[model samples]
Target: MNGIELIVIAIAMYAVAYKLYGNFLIKRLEVNNSNPTPSHTMNDGVDYCPAKPPVLLGHHFASIAGAGPIVGPVIAAGFGWVPVYLWILFGAVFIGGVHDFSSIISSVRHQSKSIGFIIQTYIGESGKKLFLLFSWATLILVIAVFTIIVADTFTHIPSSGTSSILFILLAIAFGLAIYRFKVSLTIGTIVGVILLFLCIFAGNYFPIQLNALTWQLILFAYIFLASVTPVWILLQPRDYLNSFFLYALMIGGLVGVFFAAPSINIPAFSSFSLDKVGYLFPALFVTVACGAISGFHSLVGSGTTAKQLDKESDARLVGYGGMLIEGLLAVLSLTAVASMVNKEFIDILVNKGPVPAFSLGVARFLNAIPFLNISSEAGQTFSALAVSAFALTSLDTAARLARFMFQEFFEVKENPEKESIFQNRFVATGITVAIGAALTFSGQTMSIWPVFGSANQLLAALALLALTAWIAYLRKGILFVMIPMLFMFAVTLTSLGMLVITNYNSENYTLSVISLLLFLLAVSLGFKTYNVLVNGKETSRELI
Candidate 1:
């Protein structure tokens, strides 16, 4: 099949989903534009300030889109693009989109509480604690893995290092302009794009190469600060600005696939042997988590995006739209790799332990742009910078989410109670980043990616279960959410069981234990949440 055909079909499916299924969710959720959102009701300058849909879209998309779409599909391509493509297409529309949209709307309804709090309101206190713990661990893993991922990208490509620094500086400037000087969105976006391109130019002229360890330390410090700062100061504006690069890359990829019209060179289906890429049953589903459905989206959607949402109606756009776009990115990444990546480079990609495999795929896509003067090396560097931008957003956003969970853990109810030094945002953020940094420094993050994928999908299943409980509480239709939840539960639990066997064989007892624990937590939580949905009398009455 032609690569462009793949792109076209994916786009068509996403469009139909947005029009049909997305609208169905919005209506089902009863998104009332007249009702005040938490952002408007609370209006806390730090985390709860109301944001226009467009800006929120930028932040939501950038945060959730992180290297997952690129990295997951590229790694899963060993099973061939056909399976990956099918999963991305169907999974995003039916599973991921629903999960994200429900999480956001649920949070918005609950005054922008995290999914853990929503679980508490509808499920039980015990389920809430377990879900929050799961969510926190997932966010910390995100921080550790993404920090290493971005640091490795920067270390590998000096130009990306230079460009990443420039991107940060530009984001700060844009934030100051928009928030302090009250710059218009149009002008701010224009300035941001101009500065972004300038960063690319500056990157080539003044590259800053560093060792991987040094980059990791610096990134840890950067996220520590980024996490504590007010959202308007960095997180929102930075992600909004960084999103331009993502949009450009996605659009460029589609255009390249269309005009270049590359043929599918990779196999449509590889053997299901464990040696090649594990069994297609669980490994394929787990390895390709983000492109299809990821539980991490629930963390971002409830933990941050809900706080900034301006309208209840916008949840459909920001939540469902973001997943579809990420799915499109996954499709693009798979097409680029399947059609263009050389056989020899696959070994290098596996050995080198960075994102350059996808970078090289993106480079080929860029090279196909009509009349573009980009060299292979330059295209690779640019792609690296773009992916690093994604990693950067993911690391800090994950850090921010971690901080939220930490504070939530303490259950500090008021401003006076939160005055304790330990409750300070910096302290919370510092503690969160510290744990992730330790894991990253130990070089354990990469080894745990498979397990992380399982945990992530499991989180998605749990999130869906939570959503189903809430829908049941409201006496609303929940078959949509419940079906997807069951599917993900099966896929992820099987993946976790397989990981237990693999980890035991490899003598990685820690992961083995964690996998078993997660399996148990998921099953127990599933049984409890399902009972909450079934036994209506048992539903928690203390809720928003």
Candidate 2:
């Protein structure tokens, strides 16, 4: 298969899906901008504040993105480009789009609360607790995984470190300039984009070398601040700008694929069982979560994006369109590896990591363009740094989402006057990041990646179960939700069971036990959702 054909097919499918299937979701959700969203109803300036759809899309897309689309697809190419390709294309449209769009709408209807709240309303109080515990722990793993990824990126490509720091400082000023002050979006964005380009150029010229451990510590401290601060102050603006980096990369990559017309050297079907991940059946599904469907997207949609959504009408673009855009990225990531030979692919995957394989592969794609005049070394560095910067976006966003889960977990619903130390955002955030930081040293990044992927898919299953209950409450079509829910549950449970046995034999009891816990949580939630949908009283009520 040619990379260009893959790109073309992906683009067409994604566009059609966003429009046709997106309308189906809109009818079920029954949304309108005429109605006030949680962002307006519960405007708290910090976590809950209305944002323009474009800016929200940028932030939402960047948050759920990071390196997942690149790293996962690049690594999963080992299984076979064809399988990974098919899954990313159809799974993203049918499964991922539905999951993300419904999650946002569910949260919006419930005053932009987390998925735990949706479960609590449709399921039971106990179910909510289980889901929150499951969700919070999943988020911590996300933080740990991303922290290690970003740190390692910086350690190897020191230019990424310099670029990231520059981004942080620039994002702060950009946020205040456009949002706080009276600067027009046009003027502010113009200056901010120019500065962003300068940051990229500066990164290549002046690099700051640091070890992985030191980078990890610095990242922990940075996320601590990023989480506690207001959304617009740092995260929102930073991610908004970060989206441009990704958009440029995707566009350039597509153009490169067109010009290069690279024939895939890797087999369309390599083996049923991939080299490291063993079985392809469930491993490929879990490994490619972000590119296809991810539980983490639910967290971001409900935890942060729902809270900031300007209107119900914008949900389709931010939620549904975001997933399609990401699917395109996953296709590009796979194309990166498909263009390489088995020897080069294995060497990069085994030696460096997924990011570098994607980086080097994409650099070659760009090199095929005659007019741009990009060198291999410079293009590769740029690709790696861009990925690392987005990975940093995931690190802090996970911390904030984790903090939200922690605070919500401890809330005294019965007695509103009751107070606890856990209610304090700083305390909750500190505890969250502290725990994630601890896990960074617990295992190597590569060792942790597989478990992280499994746990993430498991979380998605639980989230889908919760979404099914919500759809039942709405008295809408539950078939769409139900199918994906069951399929992911089957895939995740089998994968986790495999991990439990695999890790236990390797004497990795910690990860083994963690996998078992995730398995238990999914089963518990599935039962709860089942009982609610079948045994509970009629759910049709005034909810909008």
Candidate 3:
């Protein structure tokens, strides 16, 4: 099949899903524009504030569509384009989009509560604690890995490093201008774009050359501060500003795909080999988790996006619509990798990192644009910076969510009269950063990340279950969420079991133990949720 055909088909699928299934979801959820969102009702400006749909959409997309989709699809291409494409198509429509859409609406309905707290409300108090701890740990691992990824990108390519620094400063300035100085969005955005261009040139001329470890330390410190600050002050404005770069990357790649008209050079399938890419059933599911269905999307949906949503109507656009867009990105990444890249480049991507593979493929695509005059080197650098922007945008959002999880874990709100040091935002964010930093430097994180797929999918299953419960409480049919939840639970559990066996055989008992514990926890929670569902009993008044 031709690469252009693949892209066209993928686009068609996404459009059809968005119009038909997405509309179905919006109708079924009974989204009402008349209802005031938590952002308006609880306008705190720090954590809760009404945001325009465009601005919130930028933040939502930037937060959820990280490098995971690119990396996962590129690597999973080992199983062939057919399997990956099929999963990305159907999974995004039936599973991922549903998960993201339901998560946001569910949280909005619950007054912008975190999924962990929602789990507690629908399940049990213990369920809440367990879910929060599990989610917090996962966020730490996510932060550590993404931190290292960005820092390593900067350490190797000093130009991107400089651009990233300038990018942050621009975000802060944009935040202050809009929030503090009352500047119009149009002016703030214009200035941000100009500064971003300057950032590119300035980075090329004067780059910051630091080792990966040093960059990691510096980034962790920045995250510590960004996490505790108000969302509008840093996270929202930064993400909104950084989104332009991502938008450019996506547009450029799409134009490249259209004009380049590349062919699918890679094999259609790998004959279903475990040694090559593991069993296709569970491994394929986990490997392609992000583009298809990611639990992390649920976190972002419920974490900050719900809090800032201006109206219930926007949830469809921001949640369901965002996942479909991400699915398209995954398709584009896979198309580029399979058609434009070679075996040697694939090996480097597998062994080193997926960034180079994506950059090179993007470079090839952009090379076809005659008027752009984009050289191979220039395209590679641009793609790298764009990917780095995605990772860096996600970093602080994850940290802030982790801080919220920490506060919930400590029951900080149970008694508003007394102050607890641990409940302080700074203290919570500090702990989150410290744990993530320690993990980043531990050297075990690289080994542990493989299990991340299972853990992440497990989280998604749990999120789906939570959403299912919420729908059940509303007395709506939950067949949509329930089917996916059962499938994900089985797939993730199987993947976790496989990881346990794989680790034990390799004598990596530490990871084996950790995976086993996670497996057990997921199973236990699954069982509890099942018991509640079957018995038709509500244990917590929080749900009512």
Candidate 4:
């Protein structure tokens, strides 16, 4: 198959799925916007604030998309593009879309609390505590690594550094105009988007060079403010604007594929070239989790998206639709590389990394434009800037989500007293980002990252369990939720088991022990979930 055919089929399938399967899932949730969302009912104007569908969708999409869809799909293409494509398509439409939509709706139904709190009500207090602790730790790791990554990118590509600083300023102004000055949405968006392009051009015209450490420090300060301030000020506008870069990139790739008509040069069904790539089953599933289904997406939904939801009905668009959009991006990423032969793809993969390979692929795509006479070098730079922007987006979003998790973990459940310091948003955000920054500068992110990599899919599996438990508690149809839940559990456990053995054999006892601990966490959660599914007649409200 050629890249054009893949793109066309993907677009059609995703559209149909959203119209048909998406509606079915929406009906299961019994979505009604009649009741005020937490954005209004629990509105504090900081975290809990309402947003229009476009704005929130942009925020949600940019937050979840990150460098993940680009990087994950590219590497998972090692298992072969055919398998990668199918998994992304099926996983997003079925497993990922359902997981994201269910999580958002469930959280919206429960006062826009984090999933950990939801698990507490349905599963047990112990479950909530464990999940939150695990999530918070993972998020800190995310914050640290991405901060380091974005900083490195900025140092290497000083133009992106210049663009990013201007980008943040532009987002803040856009947010202020829309929210504080009460500018109309249509006008604000027009101005914001036009200025966004200008910012990109400005970066290319006049680059600003800085050391990685300096860039990292600047990012730390930026994220600290991004986390503590109202979502309206920075998070919403920045992410909303950030989406345009990705949209443009995807469009360029698809158009290039259409015009270039590149055939799939990579072998199709080579899911397990054991010497080149590991076993296909669990490895591909976990590696490609971001574009398909991610446990982290659920956290973003419950932690931030839920709080900003304007209506119950918006969950379908922002949650399910967002995942499918990401699916397209995964497809685009796959197409970029799949168009190239195995030898050339592996050459760049080994020499530079997934990001560069993706960048080069996209460059080829855009350079296919004959009329415009675009250069591959320029296209690569454009793609790199977009990657850096999203990576920075993920870093800050992770910090804000971590702050939410940390505060929720510590807040008094039956509070009848004054708020504690830990519950204070400023204090919570400060501590969360601080620790993450410390880890990045201290050179400890690499070792702990492998642990999180293993735990990432495990997190998804546990989240699916929580969603399944919710379905069982409702006495509704469980097959849709149950099947995916089981598959993820098998994938996660198998991967973790492999890690345990692999690490133990290599005498990397720290990772081996940590992997074992996570293995146990998943097991405990499974038992609690089983009990809930079998005998969960009591209301979560009553349990609370």
Candidate 5:
């Protein structure tokens, strides 16, 4: 099939899932109810706050949909399009969307707490702590890896002085408009997006060019400040504005696929090869998680999303339906990579440059539009900037999440009780900045990417197991969850084991071995917790 056809198929699949499963099954299951109030109910008109549906959707989408969807598929195209396409559709509908929707619903029904808190209540405290620790460790890796990615993308741009200045100005204006002027979020976002595009255009007129090192330093500084600041002042406003970039990216990708009409020539299944950097089974599952399904989404779903859900009924559409849209994004990304000739695609991959390849593909579409001349170089630069924007947004979200995880882990109590909330927020932000700084200095962030896919997949497996056990305990069916959970667990464990052995032989094994061992330990704990749940033992809730 051609690229356009694949995109159409993906959209149709998502639409059907939204209608039949999201709307119908959600109502049938009686999952729509507004009883259990979210725990973090207090709102200060910013973070930890309730919001209207549109704004909440924007926030959720920006946080959950990141470079994962784009980068994963592009990387997976090394295997072929068929596996990428299949995994996205099936995984998004059955695994990813279900996990996201159920997590949000569970949180809403139990007071909007983090997933760890809810696990404590339903599974046991031990289970909760284990999950939280695993989650926290995973989040730190996420923040570290994404920070490096953004830095790399920014530094890759030809040192145009105008772009850097414009970006800083845009950020300042965006920060003030939302935090000081109290402008409507929607309006501020629109203005910020417009200004960002203008900066890109104005970049061409600048005589000054930035070097890679300078861009890196500047970006690190920006991240440091952004991490410590309040969400309203920077993170939220920036993410809100950046959503437009994601939208434009999606549009560009879709249009490219449609006009190019490139056919998928990769076989339905490639030889089972382990010699490649990323193998198929587990890697495919991990790489495609954000687009199809992600345990990370549960973090966002239970963390901030539950608090802002205006009504219980919105959960299906916002949670499940939204995931499907992300799945479509993955599909489009896959189509773009798949459409390229094998030799051309390999050259791009060998160059270690996704932006250039993506832009070249996009230029083909632009050229198809008569009189619209988009040079390959210009397209490449645009792609680079877009990618940089994507990486930055992901970094911000991941940093915030890491902060949340740290605070939850340390459980540092606030004095005078009333100050507890503020204390928690402050501590979390501090932790985020510290981690970001460490990662920037160490330069070990990219090393973590190889394991990122597996770690994330493992988290999803654990979450599904917990959710399934909870449902079964509540007299719901368990088989549906059990089958996939076991499959993913096996796949992830195998991959983790392979990574451990490879690292061990290389004589650089401390962190990798530790991570592998910890994952195994978690697996053991998860099984013990599962047995307790299934047997209906009089267990202390703290064991979770």
Candidate 6:
């Protein structure tokens, strides 16, 4: 198929899955409630209040659709478009969407709690501890890699400093407009997004230069403030606004691809091309997580999203449908990367990272469009900047999630007595900064990349098993969840084991060995979790 036709087919498949499989999951699971009581029903205008569907969607999509959708597809395209397309369609519809929907629905039935809590309740105490530890460690890796990614993008040229500053100011202004002025969130978001685009142009006009150390310090300060501030004031507004930029960039790339109508020059498959590094199976799974499936979505579904859900039925729309949209984005991104020539493709893979390479492909596609007159340099800059924006959005979400995990792990009760919510926000901010600092300082950080992909896929396999067990226990259809869960478990385990053996043979001794060991630990824990859930005595309260 041609580029545009391939994209259309993928999107149509996603729509069918959303309507048929998504609906079936909801019905079979009996997620409908006659008198639906979302966790946000008790929302005291704080963390647990009913947000409008649009605002809630904006928040959820922004949080979930991070650098993964961009980075993974581009990197995977190195193998070929066939694998990338197949994995995204199958993975997103069956695996990613299922994990997302189940998580949100499960959290709503309980209270708006973290997935760790749900695992603890349903899986067993040991399961809970293991999941939480893995979550914390994985999140740390996410924050580290994404932080460097953001830093790299923002510092690509001396001028990006202005764009960074402008974004921070716009976030603050957007926050105040909503919180203090009581403006409609949608209206505020529109203005904030417009201003963000203006800032991009402003970056070109009024460039700022700063030393790397100075830039790091400034970025740290901005993130600290952003984390501590109220969601309405900064977090929600910034993310909501940034979502528009992300969508625009994505849409623009898609339009460019279609208009250019670039031919797919790469072969459907390459002969076990091991020169790029990493095993194909695990690497493919890892690179395609957001497009296919991701454990992180479960956390988001349970953490903040379940609360805002106005109705149980909305889970299909917000969770499953939203994932389908992300899947489309992945397909579009992959197509853009695939359209590039082999030499240009390898150059991008080697020099500017996967995201930048993908952007370069998009730019090349856009340059082919009639009447656009986009320059190569300009397209490259736009691609880089757009990536920086999206990557930062992901980093922002990860920082918040990490903070939540840290607090939960410490068992810090949500007490109003010790400090105001804003004070607690400051604590969260501090934790985020500390995470960034540690990642920045550690010279051993690069090793995180090789194993991060598999580690994430491993987490997805574990979550699927846990969710499937819970559903079966709840008297839902076991066949659908069971067979798929087993398949994923086997695939992930085999892939992870291969990765370990490969790394061991390479003997580039570092913390990667630690990551391999963690994968093994996850496997053992998974078996134990399955055994306990199957044979253990039932309790009134679920325990992970």
Model 4 weakest 10-residue run by lDDT: 535-544
Per-residue lDDT of model 1, residues 1-544, tens digit only = 8888898999999999999998899888898999899998988789998887888999999998888888788877887777889999999999999999999999999888888887878777788879888888888888888887788778877788888888888888888888789999899899789989898888889989899889989988888888777788888988898899989888876887766788888788775753645888888888787778998899999989999999899998999999999999999888877875447446745785336777777677778887776777877767777887788888889999988887776664444244566667888888888899888878777777668888988989888988988887786777888889889999989988988998899999989999999999998988888687657673543232
TM-score: which is higher, 4 or 5? 4
What lDDT tens digits, residue by residue, belong to model 6 across residues 372-433? 78887777788777667767776767766666665555553454246544246567558657
Question: Candidates sorted by TM-score, descending order?
Answer: 4, 2, 3, 1, 6, 5
Q: Tell me, what's the RMSD of every candidate?
A: 2.9, 2.3, 2.7, 2.5, 4.1, 3.7
- For 1-544, candidate 2 gives per-residue lDDT tens digits of 6999999999999988888899988987788878899888888889898888888999999999988899889888988799999999999999999999989988998888899988878888898888888789878878888887788788877877888999999999988987789688778878888899799879869999989999999999999999989998899999998888888888888898988899999988888897677788898898898879998999999999999999898999999999999999999999998999888898989998898899888898888899998888877877877787788998889999999899888977687357689978999999998899877877754565667787788777877888888777766778888899899999999998998999999999978997898788788788877777667763443323
Give a tens-digit lDDT track for model 5, residues 1-544: 6877888888888888888878654753467455534523555444555445555665677788876787777777776778878899998888788888877777776656667766666667776778777887777777667655655555455434466457656866787876578888778777788897888778776635546556556665666566556555566556656666667767766776666677875555565452445667666776677887777888878766776676777787778877887898788767666667778877887786655666666656555544446666666666666666666666666666666666565543232234355347656676666665677678777766677777787877777776665655555555556666777787678778877887788776775776587568557756765676656643332221
Give lDDT per model, in order.
0.84, 0.87, 0.86, 0.87, 0.68, 0.72
Q: What is the C-alpha local distance difference test score of candidate 3?
A: 0.86
Q: Give the Å shift of residue 408 in candidate 4.
A: 0.8
Better of 1 and 2 by TM-score: 2
Candidate 6 lDDT trough over 10 residues, lowest sum: 535-544
Stretches of model 5 off by over 4 angstroms after superposition: 36-40, 158-192, 203-221, 224-230, 371-373, 412-423, 478-482, 537-544
For this target, which candidate reaches the highest TM-score against the unseen true structure? Answer: 4
Flag regions of model 3 displaced more than 4 Å.
Answer: 274-276, 341-352, 412-419, 537-544
Off by over 4 Å in 4: 271-277, 416-418, 538-544
* TM-score of each predicted structure versus truth: 0.94, 0.96, 0.95, 0.96, 0.87, 0.90
Local error of candidate 6 at 445, Å? 1.0
Please write out the lDDT profile of model 3 over residues 95-189, one tens digit for every residue.
99999999999999888888887888777778888999999999999999989888988888898888888888888888889878989999888
How many residue pairs clash (N, CA or C atoms closer than 3 angstroms) in each of the candidate models, in the order given?
Answer: 0, 0, 0, 0, 17, 12
What tens-digit string does per-residue lDDT give for candidate 4 at 1-544?
7898999999999999999998899777678889789999999989899999999999999999998899888988877888899999999999999999999988988899888988888898899999999999999999999988988888988888888889899999999999999999899988888998899899879999889999989999989999998899999999999898888888888888877898999888665744433588778887887889888899999989999999988998999999999999999999998888899998988788898899988899899978757799989888988888999999999999999899888867687145888988899989998899889988978877766655877777778788777776776676787788899989888878988998899999988888898999999999998877656663332221
| Error of model 2, residue 196, in angstroms | 0.5
Error of 6 at 201 (Å): 1.0
